[model samples]
Target chain A: MRPLGDDTGPAIEVRGLRKLYGQTVALHDIDFEVSKGEIFAVLGPNGAGKTTTVEILEGFRPREGGTVKVLGEDPFRADEEWRARIGVVLQTTGEFEDLNVREVVRHFARYYPDAQDPDELIERVGLAEKRNARASKLSGGQQRRLDVALGIIGRPEVLFLDEPTTGFDPSSRRDFWQLIRDLATSGTTIVLTTHYLEEAEQLADRVAVIVGGRILDIGVPQTLGGRDTEATVVSWMGPDGLESVHTTAPTKFAADLHARLGGEAPGLTVHRPSLEDVYLQMIGADTAATAALASAAGVTTEDS
Target chain B: MTVLTVAPARRLPRARLRRIASLGLYRGQLELLQFFRGTETVVFSLLFPVFALVIFSSMFDGEIAPGVTYSDYLVPGIIATGLMVTGFQTLAISIAIERDRGGLKRIAATPMPRSAYFIGKVIMVLVTSVVETVVLVAVSVVLYGTHLPGTADAWLTFGWVSLLGVTACALCGIALSSLPRNSRSAPAVVAPFAFVLQFISGAALVFTDLPPWLQWIASAFPLKWMCQGLRSVFLPDSYAAQEAAHSWQLGWVAVALIAWVILGTVLCLATFRWTKTRDGG
Candidate 1:
């Protein structure tokens, strides 16, 4: 559709974005980009301009001021043909009260020139049997799958999913992730905004944490929140019974302990700062002392 | 991947019509199905005009405007009322619901032209209006021996009234739809003022004997002119003997109807919301 507006362009690019709701500013100079064929996650708490930025990108909300290029075209002024090349799964969509799952998918399929077969999409979303079930009757997770099915039905080059698995249970969330992974493997650029940190860790190739209308940092989950360079807390059984040490190099500590004991270190174990720990630190939390140290060292942050 | 080529159905126009017609038919079926399933909307829409028809005709039977039978005068008025209730009132509720359910939002996100959604809704209302008119006419003929207008002029009047009535109502509906906070609040906002308008200016109240102030209010509204036009079709020439401006006052009737349609259309285009605006800030 419209030649993808220059193949060399990033999947999306936003610069100097600003939005105001009356006297309150919803977004302030927010900027981000998604390279081709990568899963980019926008992480934020509620009221963090996540929805506003995504809505503006989807052309559902007007921008107060910004330059947004989606597939190298200004999304706000893009025509239907441009819309055909991108897919958006909003927070929620209209529930087709009477139509079965298949019918609803089939109906939306007509709006696009190149649409995926509804039956196949239904199966892909793990709702093959429930395809004939009315949308209103489907369980929450199943209904969410239908939302995903509709999003992908256009066979879009870029997909924007807003908390796609927010209400999903553990098993359903996993299944939904696999579906997304499948799409990404086939070269679909995915932009996701979610509240779940673990979800970002599992799905996003690069995650950006946004707060108070600006991005705090962007990196791989392990390296984000200054996770990679942080010291690990090592614990083991000493001659006295038990011992533990917080060290920058757990491997070297274990090696020294082995020489002291003349054998393997007893009950050898190590605890390192998790991605969540580093996240809490960047957003400013008291318990992230290790994360603070990582930040101060300048070794923790990894720019992606 | 296995490649399977399917032949395009390029031979028959009838087959093409059938395929295309099915989409519209499905949408229409969905509309009617939703209408009937909602007990509150159906009861209010169907019963309000019927109650008006029964009460007014009974109260003024054989004495309305001299020679005109109350039932004869009331039937046309009720049909006009039905058009308003079904189109205008229904439009307000439907648009509010669409906003609340994110239907408008969803449609806005799609490649489908935004106008198509409104057009489809108006078409649904038009179909329902036609059916309501037929039902009212049937009941009038069966229960009260009310005659369908005999000549081509009478049919012409019906056509114009139906078209103008629906157009005005739909436009007004779209305009007023933006007033409600959500679907639950829709009735609280729309029903009160709507009933107030009908109560003051509506023809169902036997306006021939009403106070001067009430008559002035009725005269100020387009529904008054619409009802007056409908009455001209059914009531005999002697019925006009009591009208303040006797001989139908066709000029005022035409002007009021045109004014409402134009004003209503402009308002709808200007203010109708396709998506919800967060009210917190």
Candidate 2:
């Protein structure tokens, strides 16, 4: 097959994507794009449709309505070449129980035309310590790490990770994050779905907030829900006691406090809204908005 | 990406086809490795038929025909059972479990040709069934004076019959794997299904000794034909008189097995599912 799209276009594109699990609408008109080499994160709570969206993009699930293109080809109709360009790391999997970590990695490497060196990939994912450990013998965290190694062994052009690092320790998560960053720098597009908002802030170039089967917002982590310009909570020790103020400009507030003290302000701290704060606030707002609509409809009562 | 001069929508180039074939070979090799390494399954599948043969040979120590001993009859029956156990029961249960584990879905995500998985599974089935057959044959030959096919023609018959039996049973496994609701229920569903078939198909019970209704029912299935085909090779020509037909219907046996192979292929292609996601997304 000839190349699908120009290298400059977005690596993944979705528009008006809709999915239903029987009668229940699982995803409603979801929309987004992951540009080439960009690390895009999807943030949502459990059952908030993050996995559904990611699965659809990964060609693991079918959408009832909408168009999706990963690497400029519809994933549902993608050929082997199209498939060779993408990789997926699901939440958890049980496979190769009899095979060791090294064997499993090497097994997956055979699927692609151009694959990463299995040993180097295992090392990159920090499975070197347990390279010979049987899959069934691995701890929960180690199993998840092996899954990550398998996902990247194909050297895919685009990778999909759904709640990766769930079972990882702090250091492992850090190492995994570094590995992701390295992959992105080498022009691998990544779409990550995570419940951990800090992970989104840490690795995602852009983040999408999906709630109740709909996308609430999509922007850079710093500006998601206007986090960059939104009010920052600044606190200081005043003459009376401790004082806190919400201001759009935290630096000016801190400077004013510094001037008032004619020196460094004691216990003075400036804090902007974190990505987690914005995510939770967005989810809370969506909940509140639905509740408001329900109450406006007389608390779900039928009209007489 | 390599630029191509001619554009064909679905036709793969020769080199890619070769690569896919080689990849499937590698996948098959790994599958065999995994199967042999699996201790519990390996031991159970390998010995179940041999045990049945030994028990039956001891229980029925009389002449099946004038020159044919019960061991001669039981060897072929047990070989048929061995093929079914490896090709049908074990394969179905293992595939169900693997699908539940997301292994099939993971493989589906790769650029790996769909044929690679089937090739791998078929190779495992073929090799294990042959091994199961050989172990049962050797045990009968050494311990019970059971004779093997001495002539080249008889040996060729054995080979083709064994190959067809394995192909039909493996396809049955692939098709019926979708019947189980989930992995936990697979063994429960597949084992009893195979168990009842063996009894009715004369692998466990004597085909001619059973009632005409059971005989007719057995005749309709491939397992009975497989046993009949094997019995013709392992037993003396006089033993054909003991068959339900009073003669070895090798022609009808081949037809039934080939028909079942076709049916199983259709069902496998039509019903094989990579994932059974009953939980709402």
Candidate 3:
């Protein structure tokens, strides 16, 4: 890896990025910036333009309109030098026949001017045991591990991973998350899209929700859509049975409950909406808004 | 909680064709490795032509001319058949699978030079063609008692015919790869086309017996001329009476082959894709 110069700028920048297939827009007005070392997660449901957005940035797909810059270079007009700086793990792709884990990694390693040791990379991605196993022989999760190893082999400054850990078991997912963090800790800017909300909450420093070809919200996980500040649900085992209240003042509400019986409030518990909760809420709200706009414009939806 | 810095992007060194050639040569080694590793596919694809030659030569057993055995006439055409199978059939399947199967698109994202890949494919075709040639010719001379070409002129003709034939067929294979909707359907398109071409083009040793329309169809493709060119190398000049033109026509064969190579190049440029979908870029 080369030394980073003293330039203060985001690793990735997108302004008014738009994509279209015929008259239907796949993505529009898409914009965001990812600082170096930040783990930025793009969260969305299926067909929400997540893949389109990432593909445009990865230079695999052309955009209709936008100013997109990755590492101070236009990715759409990307050159070899620009390619050397970025890594991509696209949503599950076909692996090569006859190439074992180590060989494929080493093969990709040669494409870069500076690449991590193939053996060390295999170990890093936790495919050490399967180093000699041919690609066809590996299980799905193992194959994904190989994909991750190949993605980071060049020691890319910015890595784009689209559902990279889809097939992993729980333990492997955790290990993979830790490996992602290790990469970020060393100053690699990471952008990942995944169906797993907990993955975003656990790994992302900041997250964005994209829905219907546009951004629904963007914020740190704790405060995304005010998840941290959303009304908390307070519950306790009351005289009749379990009772509950949704309140912004959970602490005060709990105290009031505590004093009401002049004793312990049995089975008292408090919790707020989680990341998944807020994310689904945002998707739901977006759907309603789009439907309302369509109805007002007298455009009949498919279901309608 | 902390700021981060990353390695700065740098420009590539100047375009050096020598460096590109060496890089391509290295990638070619991996291509060879992958090919040989698929033991069943390699063995079956290369051996089918040799076996076909033996069966047809034995069944058509007799001297077609004064002391000119059928094996003598059959060996060269079979060698051409070997080249077609290795260069056209195998390459089309492999490249289609490699593309739709995800390897090409993955490679596309890297800093690997675009030319290196085609160069690697060329090298792979050359290496495999060599194996097919050695095996087919050895079987012809040692097992069937076929005579070797007696002159350097014959050997020179052999070299150019084999080279041009493989180049043309291999490029056609690549151009045709994107025609398959996906890797799974590659053989569905390639196999029938290759087999049909060989029969009509004289690999079955029946080009003269085919209907005029069929012969004309064979003449339109590179395989017929390739087979005709190879036949000129092994059979005596007097045996040219058996050919449709009653002349060697080696020059026309070369011209036809070079034309196919040019056409194949154009088709490859127009139709090739890194992936199966229209979204492929």
User: For residues A1-304, what per-residue lDDT tens digits would candidate 2 score against the true structure?
Assistant: 6464557678888999999988999898888888899999987766778777877787767679999988887777677777788899865676688889999998889888799999998888888989998898998888888888878888888999977878777788888899999999999999998766678888999999888899999999878998788777787788898887888888888888888889987887676666766666788844323321221111211111
Superposed by TM-score, candidate 2 places the C-alpha of residue B105 at a distance from the truth, in angstroms, of: 1.6
- Candidate 3 local lDDT, B58-108, one digit each (tens): 788788777677778778888998999888999999889887867887887
What proportion of the true contacts does each candidate reproduce? 0.26, 0.54, 0.38
Among the numbered candidates, top lDDT falls to: 3
The TM-score-based order of candidates, best leading, equals 3, 2, 1
TM-score versus the correct structure, for each prediction: 0.87, 0.89, 0.90
What lDDT tens digits, residue by residue, belong to model 3 across residues A76-129? 676777788899886446556687877888888988889999999899888889
Report the error of model 1 at residue A40, Å.
1.3
Q: DockQ for each candidate?
A: 0.24, 0.36, 0.31
What C-alpha lDDT do the candidate models reach, one value each?
0.75, 0.82, 0.82
lDDT of 1 by residue, B46-97 (tens): 7777777777676765755565677887787788888888888887888888
Considering every candidate listed, which one attains the maximal TM-score? 3
